[model samples]
Target: FWESLLMQLLLFRESLLIHLLLFRESLLIKLLLFWESLLMQLLLFRESLLIHLLLFRESLLIQILLFRENLLMQLLFFRESLLTQLLLFRESLLTQLLLFRESLLIQLLLFRESLLIQLLLFWESLLIQLLLFRE
Candidate 1:
């Protein structure tokens, strides 16, 4: 009977040692899995941050392009308006020059008519004076 009890005690000790080893192995595996999950989460977070940064940069570039386009449109409008004003100024100058030319032509005609009248009066006076001298 004592030998049987000794054998049973040794078997229980061996089984306890085996159970302890398995528990230790399972605990190590669980810790390693937890660490791996944490590492994957960190990598995913970093990737998301990079994506957000790229999107922000793209949006900023688009805003700059839009501002430049608006500026170009304004400059174009300004140039068109300036051209129209210049054309109007040119037309007004031409009209003034034509008016000046017409006035000068009318003045020249009046001067010629006055000179002819004076010549006719001088001739009539000379004839009368000659006739009086003859009488």
Candidate 2:
């Protein structure tokens, strides 16, 4: 009976060591898998950040193109309006010049008619005086 009890105690000690070793191996594996998952999450976050930066660059390019187009359109409109104003001013100047020319011509014609009437009256008076002296 003493030898049997000693053998049973030895077997129980061997089983407990085996159970402890298995539990330690399982815990190590759990820690390794957790670290691997954390590393994968960090890589995924970096990739997402890179994608967002690329998208932001593309949007910046689009905004620059739109601004350039708008600036070009504004320049074109300004040029057209400037040309229109110039043409209108030229037309007004020409009309004013023509009106001034017409007014000067009318004054010259009226002055010429008055000078002719004065010359005719002077000739008639001279003829009447000469006829009275002959009588």
Candidate 3:
């Protein structure tokens, strides 16, 4: 019975770890997709602005230059922010995984201790029984 329970606990732990891994992967993919979409949008906006400037001549050139500079600044800020978020998320995931591993180790140790106690109890009972039979 204890063995069966232990097996179930192990299986549960494996499944939980697998789920956490999948969740972490999905989060990373989502962040990557978000960053990619932002880049694509920036490129499209820049191309549209360039086309407008070409059609309008010098009048629009000044505005286009300013807009481009501002856009670049914004992009730089956004990229930095995204990078920071990614690093933070990665660190959080690592911490969670480490904690889960520690918990699993603790649980396993407890299971082992319980099994040892059971074995000792069984031995003591057997010794008592033998003495009674001899009497």
Candidate 4:
């Protein structure tokens, strides 16, 4: 009877060890599956974010173009008004005055155009920095 009890105890210990090892393996498999799912979700979220960023950039580009067009139109209208002034003063004794005003206006407009170009360049650099930061 003593020998039989010792054999049963040994068998029980072996079965318990097997069960523990199998349980550990199953847990590891579940953990791996969970990690894979999380990684896939992260990738999908990143792709969606990229799409949104592209759309936002497109809209901003369009708005900047429209702003540039509006500025150009305003500049053209100003030029036309200057021409009208020139024609009106052409036959008068104020030729020197007219020339001085015309030259000054042209210089001012050129300065404004340079300033706008600088501002646009600033915006473009800022946008590129933002995009780089995201990556």
Model 3, 1-135: lDDT tens per residue?
999999999999999999999999999999999999999999999999998878788767888999999999999999999999999999999999999999999999999999999999999999999999899
Expressed as tens digits, the lDDT of each residue in 2-28 for candidate 2 is: 889988888888888899989999999
Candidate models: Cα lDDT each: 0.94, 0.92, 0.95, 0.93
TM-score of 1: 0.69
> Mind giving the per-residue lDDT tens digits that candidate 4 earns over 1-135?
989999999899889999999999999999999999999999999999999999999999999999999999999999999988888877564778888899999999999999999999999999999999999
Clashes of each: 0, 0, 0, 0
Model 3 scores worst on lDDT over the 10 consecutive residues at 53-62
Candidate 1 wrongly placed segments (more than 4 Å): 1-24, 123-135
Model 2: ten consecutive residues of lowest lDDT: 115-124
Q: Where is the poorest 10-residue window by lDDT in model 4? A: 86-95
Q: How far in Å is the alpha carbon of 85 misplaced in model 4?
A: 3.3
| Candidate with better TM-score, 1 vs 4 | 1
User: How well does candidate 4 score on lDDT at residue 4?
Assistant: 90
Candidate 2, residue 53: how far the Cα is off, in Å: 3.3
TM-score of 4: 0.57
TM-score of each: 0.69, 0.64, 0.53, 0.57
